[model samples]
Target: MVLKNLIRIRRSAARAEAEHPALAAAGLLPGLEALPNAILVLARERLAIAFANPAAEAMLGMSLRQLCQLGWTDLFPNADAPAGAIAALREEASGTTQLDAVLELPQREPLRVHAIIGSLDAAPGYVLLELVENEQKLRTDREERILDLSAVNKQLIRNLAHEIKNPLGGIRGAAQLLELELGANGGLREYTQVIIKESDRLQTLVDRLLEPHRHPHIARDLNIHEVCERVRAVMLAEFPRGLTIHRDFDVSVPDLRGDMEQLIQAVLNIARNAAQALRQPIAEGTACIEFRTRVARRVTIAKRPCKLALDLRIIDNGPGIPEEIRDRIFFPLVSGREDGSGLGLTLAQNFVQQHEGMIECESRPGHTEFRILLPLQC
Candidate 1:
């Protein structure tokens, strides 16, 4: 709809040009500056940029000043001849002429975009460039896959918990009997103690695994900041010395109906996971975590679209998530850490799902961000 309206505006500007030619030269498409899709108007004669839209600045991951300093070759230095791509763009002006290449950055990931160069109908030596990130579509598809796998994981976790529960009691009882029979024999009783201790630990883990299924959700009206504060206070208490939990919140956000405890657990689990990763850095006095919130509009979660939703981001600066297990991090038994049970994120995912929300993680060296989307009212 935005794209269509922008196109209509451009046509109107063109038609009004005969009466007001100055408007056509100076303000052909002033509104494109706010467009979501990245757009750049390049002066074909000088091979320099005339304008970079706000979306273009973000999509390119550079400031407007930085982008204006770059030419077609400077942006795509490795490409075979982006100039030819631009030359062909004007000839085949029916639609966007798609270019089959990626925009490489200095050290970051190569941004994938469908590049199309269009020519200005009124001007001969000016071309328009459009770039749309492919990651957005991939994310939408990933959400569906996550929901399907989450359903399967939920049943599997329940069945595994029940299976583990029965034998766990028998093992603990047998170990206790063995320990009692071994009475004063210190060496042998210690071994039995180990067995009993391990059994008890497993039992505790099994109980935790069944926790979400065991409790009935207690829903209530609450501000999300309350939840953030609750989590922030706990994190500060645990790692008070060097860790900083910054709050960047939208105070105008309205309260959403949710299970306060569940939401708190959900946020806590994610925040705690980040804290654990930041442990080494915290000791060196450089660890930081951000709890940022914003109002997300026209959002979709769990295959349901909400007019309003909360976009909560937990950003941390630490050695990024291990790439090997990143894709399956939310699975019940998957863990990036060797000693981790890997159920924190799984349970967090479950709690958010209970509120008809979704969580996604993006990680790279030195930067990791977890975005949670919960409906304002579901």
Candidate 2:
């Protein structure tokens, strides 16, 4: 819709150009600048950038003067589709064309965008290009799927836990009665004790699994940095000699309403996991974990849009998560380590979800980052 309106304005500018060419051109610029979508005008000769709006400047991470120094191919290096689209527009004199293309950036991931190209009637042999980022929509869709799956998984866990709790108690009680019947000095007492001890262990495991659902959320205004400090202290104490924890906080971020203890636990679980994964690095005296925070604007969580959000990242310089379990790290009973109980991330996710936040992770060979986004009222 925005593209259509901008195109219509260009046609109107062209129609009124005869007696008021300068005025028409002057009025068209403010309309483009006022728009939030990134727009760039390409010269027909070398396809060099003839104009760029403020949105384009921000999105492309370059000023109009800088953008003017580059051509379409420079901006989208080796992109065949966008090059073909420009070629067709010039040869056939097409009014408009649209395509999904990747825009390459310096030292950053390639941005996938929906590109709209139209002839600039106001300036012969020039075309206006509008770019709309597709990542936001894709992220929102992925969040929705995660939320849906989480709901189903949580319900299944609750039902399974309850079902296990009842029979589990009966089994434990039966073992106790058998133990009593056999008495302390009896031959079968050792086997009864084994049954009793194993049942108790399973009972403890079940309790941990059900703990998050049972705990009442206590909300209060809390500083996110304070929680990070607490987790850092705990992790450093555990891995004192080898590990170094760093803090990069946006102190300007305001306090948010949340369950402080739950937040601490969530952060600690992730940090502890990172510390454990950094075993080799720790032994080599090179282990590091960083707690970074920043303010994110115009963010979305669980399909709901927010004006502001707290972006908290826990990054570790260690061997990355094992690829096989990376995708299921947050799922219950899933763990990368052999002895891991596999409930830390699940509980962390649950705690964050209780405060209307979401957790996401990205990992490669030597870098792993866990990002938590919590919507802020401000």
Candidate 3:
């Protein structure tokens, strides 16, 4: 009877010590109770939730008590396990066992976890599970795929444009020669002249298509606002009479490294598009185009993080881009207006990308904004 009483006292003391906060502080209880990741603990005979972080609560959509009542096999069916054969092998192993597996929850999706089975200091038959989601890994894979596709598309455009350009120049030159020989009352000279003009126009389009590839970058330190101001002045001069152009500059934005001519051309393209959009509004005395600048930090472009970047927004309060072509507006030869060559936004995008930046457009019924995000020192 004395031996039995001593055994009971020792067991009670062990349980008390296991439940004490000192154990938690000492990191003996998995140290995951305060973490934000989903976790669970189980014993051999019956499963009890030893700890769960906030992330676990949010992920499994369950409370502490609710999860404790459920068994590992019940929460995750054996047939649906990620490492089916490995889990069975671990379960049948001799001493301490481990299984890297994924569990699919009823409310939530599949969760990747490393299940570790071993003896706690006092609890001999307990197991600890460290669950971590694979969502970020999957996201990274998707981003890599997108970048590969973008590169392939750009290469195809460059190759096709080069092939079409040489033949196009020959066609235009031949038409011009024919027109010169047919001069003086042949009247057929007019048709040759038309051919020459159309060919020249097509050749111009091809040149625009190849501009970004052919022009070598000439980068230097220059004030970004200076570039913006130059573009503004050009647009004002081109549409002097009725258009109202406003500058909302952030004076503190520092200088950027870029090719002056290319940056000017890129900004001019976007601003010119805005000016055209505002033509009817200008006639009605309600036309307004705003050039705004701001600083953005930790921006992600093309799946890469840029620490410090500059944002230039060209906003216009005119009839927005037509809804049908809005999605494909960045594609070469796709345009919203009848007379638009459809290469302005494309060229802008190409130049920005050359500077390791990105351009995006948002448009609604009455508002349209084209935002250019570029690295500050690149």
List model 1 lDDT by residue over 293-375, tens digit each: 99999877888888999999999999999989999999987888888898999999999998889999999988899999999
Q: Which structure is stronger by lDDT: 1 or 2?
A: 2
* Candidate 3 residue-wise lDDT at 313: 93
How many Å off is the CA of 262 in candidate 1?
1.0
lDDT of 2 by residue, 198-257 (tens): 989888888888888888999999999999999988998899898899999999988999
Candidate 1: worst 10 consecutive residues by lDDT?
A: 14-23
lDDT of 3 by residue, 1-378 (tens): 978944643443344236544434445443454456565555544554544454566677886556656776677775244334324434542344555666777766566665554434444444455566665554455445544655775787788888988888898889888877877857898788788888888778778888988879988998888998899899888988788889999998888888988889988998898888888888887888899999988766666777888999999998999999976777788887889998998788778888887777778877899888888742
TM-score ranking, best first: 2, 1, 3
Off by over 4 Å in 1: 1-70, 76-112, 115-131
What are the models' TM-scores?
A: 0.74, 0.75, 0.61
Clashes of 3: 0
- Count backbone overlaps in model 1: 0
Q: Rank the candidates by lDDT, best first.
A: 2, 1, 3
Query: 1 or 2, which is superior by TM-score?
Result: 2
Clashing pairs in 2: none
